[model samples]
Target: MTGAADAGAPLLEVRGVGKSYGSVSALRGVTASVAAGEVLCVLGDNGAGKSTLIKILAGAHAPTEGTLLAHGVERQFASPRDALALGIATVYQDLALVPLLPVWRNFFLGAEITVGRGPFRRLDVAAMRRATRDDLALMGITLRDVDQPIGTLSGGERQAVAIARAVHFGAGLVILDEPTSALGVSQAALVLRYIARARDRGIGIVFITHNPHHAWAVGDRFLVLRRGTSLGEFGRDEISLEALTGLMAGGAELDALGPELDRAASARDPA
Candidate 1:
């Protein structure tokens, strides 16, 4: 994947964005960007304002200050629908899926398509099934059958389905929130593979997670957030996995925790 320096302008840019509630500030001067076909990994620990940033991007909350630019144009998102209208899709960790529903049904959940005229209209089941299969295949995804309940699929497969649905709906940017948090090693790798696939297809990705290893696997750029502000942003060529992990751990803080963790391990040891 190309680095941020060569990916052209960002699909979405948040410049000096801040959020406040009365006298308390939740986020301060946070800046980041995600470009077309570029994966910008936002790395941070808890309370690092990651959620606040995502909420602002998803249009769930307005920024108290600063601007959000989409395609080089300044604008404020009125709602998630407004963002969606601009082709920004947010797939939360939960995935917003109906577990009991069949894969095809969940694929076309809200925006169901129908065949024939008004009075004779019927759910275009066959069309949706075929399209779903074809889209997944295009993204290197394969499902045993579109008729099975979505709950039967593994975590990674479900994430792929959500991604494919976003692509099929013409999303230019996809914001994924901690997509691999609950998955096993193999499952997490599967999702990361699809993330790379998404980037190769020219869809910008904002990957939010605390795991530096996962970020290093597919990120074109890295943005480290701490206590509501940005540590800084670096291109893939500019930062190493070791540096990223150190930054996320807050250097001296991680150093202090190391001995404590070792002692804790000793206390728990049977020997």
Candidate 2:
């Protein structure tokens, strides 16, 4: 736990955050927070500035305006490594695992365990394998073999592994990027379960997705974005899944389009 955890502040929070690329504003005045053991769901359609927000949080890009608070103190992340050092990790949709590598290898990819000292130092393969298997099991993921290539696993399984890896690596806040977008219904359900598991373990989660149903399933709070601006942020109890979906899909726009669509249909079939 960091100072923020002890002080009872959100594990991660962005207050009035905004980003600009030259004259184009990609995001503006977005405020949200994720406390330990909570999941904040960010929902948006394409060109809604979700990616820009993710980059800011992940430290790949700095915010042009507003504040980023980690644990209670306002801080600017100079790089992704700075965020990682503070126990913040982002798992993008790609999973960041090498397709040809074994599951256990991928789990300990950058942070490997070694034995011996000096010239005799060598990778502790056996130990890494056991740890990976146990950690995955702790996250409710069971694999037939830890030696199999990560590419052989299903999308859901890969996501589960990534989440488990982040948890094992001491991430207090994990930002997930559209983790279930391309997954099947059942696969998406599995990933959501793992997210719940992470939340239960007292990890703060930022779940970025376009699916309101999935967001509603595991989110404690929701932030809806459209065209680089926030519609609003609401607690789970304050909004229904339908309402969230409507906001994400731009309800007012859809309502206006409905009449035009109906007229077009009638034009094509006038009895």
Best by TM-score: 2
The C-alpha TM-scores of every prediction are: 0.93, 0.94
| Candidate 2 lDDT score at position 159 | 97
Q: Which lDDT tens digits does candidate 2 get at residues 9-114?
A: 8988999999999999999999999999999999999999999999999999999999999988888999999899889999998889999999999999999999
TM-score of model 2 (CA atoms): 0.94
- Candidate 1, residues 196-246, lDDT tens digits: the string is 999999999999999999999999999999998889999998989998999
Question: Which lDDT values do the candidates have, in the order given?
Answer: 0.90, 0.93
Worst 10 residues of 2 by lDDT: 1-10
lDDT of 2 at 227: 98
Estimate the Cα RMSD of every predicted model relative to the unseen true structure.
Answer: 3.8, 2.5
Cα lDDT, model 2, residue 75:
86
Best candidate (score: lDDT): 2
